[model samples]
Target: MSTSDWLFLILQFFAFSFLAIGGAMTVASDMHRVIVDDMGLLSNNEFVTAIALGKISPGPNVMFVAVLGYQVGGLFGALVLTLAIILPSTTLAYYVAKWGQFNQHRKWVVAIKAGFTPIVVGLLFSTGWIIVDGFHSMKAWILGTLVMLLVWRTRVHLLILIGLGAILGMLGIV
Candidate 1:
């Protein structure tokens, strides 16, 4: 990639880092737009696979940025995008945590927390919907719905659910 391409990649991730309210997943649709739709850096399948890989990994979901970077460039791209996406958000989270602790009893703080709860929930729902939309099979839809129901109504461990999903995938059931 050229210097300008590298700069744009870094800047785009940096901007998305700040917009990642609730979580990095919250900005996924915008990331899809910029990386796949606008820049054509990755195709639809590539983008969806990146997200799936990131979600299955042990670290933060923001790892999708690293996957995108690697897809666009290489190792350097991965490192640059990961750092760009993390730095601003990590710093802001630290200071905000301090502020929140100090102002825990304030009415505005409580109100802000209350207001953000629904927004975060909605963002999470949207993220799930986006992922689900990528699956083209009715079997996948049924399995996903069953998994969602299990998560909402039962006390089963999440890793077990994930394992079950993986098994289904391996058996070509979903």
Candidate 2:
């Protein structure tokens, strides 16, 4: 990639950090739009694969941002994109923590916090939709729905589900 492309990618993620209300996962489709559809850096399969990689890895689900950077530009690209995406959030979180400490008892603050739950849930649903939509098969849809229901309604561990999904994919079951 050229210097301009790197600049654009970094700036886009910096802006996206502010818009990441429920976390970076919520802004995944927008990332997909910019990285895959708009910039044509990665194909749909590549983007979805990156999402899979991110999901299976430990820590924040946003690891795919780094995976994508590495895909596009190698190790340095991974470092740049990870820092670009996280720095804004990290700074905001620090100040928010300080403010939240003082306003923890405020009614409006409680109300705002309560209101965010639903919004975050909705955003996560949309992100799930985007990932599931990539695979155009009934089996994939069924598996996705079943997995989602299991996650939502049961005590099953996420890593187990991920492993099962990987096995199913390998067996061409999804």
Model number with the top TM-score: 1
TM-score of each: 0.72, 0.67
Off by over 4 Å in 2: 1-13, 21-59, 68-74
Give, for candidate 1, the lowest lDDT window spanning 10 residues.
124-133
lDDT by residue (tens digit), candidate 2, 40-139: 9999998888888998788889899999888888999899989988999989999998898799889988888888899888877988898898888889
TM-score of 1: 0.72
Model 1, span 13-77: residue lDDT tens: 88999998768888889889988898888999998998989988988888887898799888987
Q: After superposition, how far is residue 171 of candidate 1 from its true place, in Å?
A: 2.4
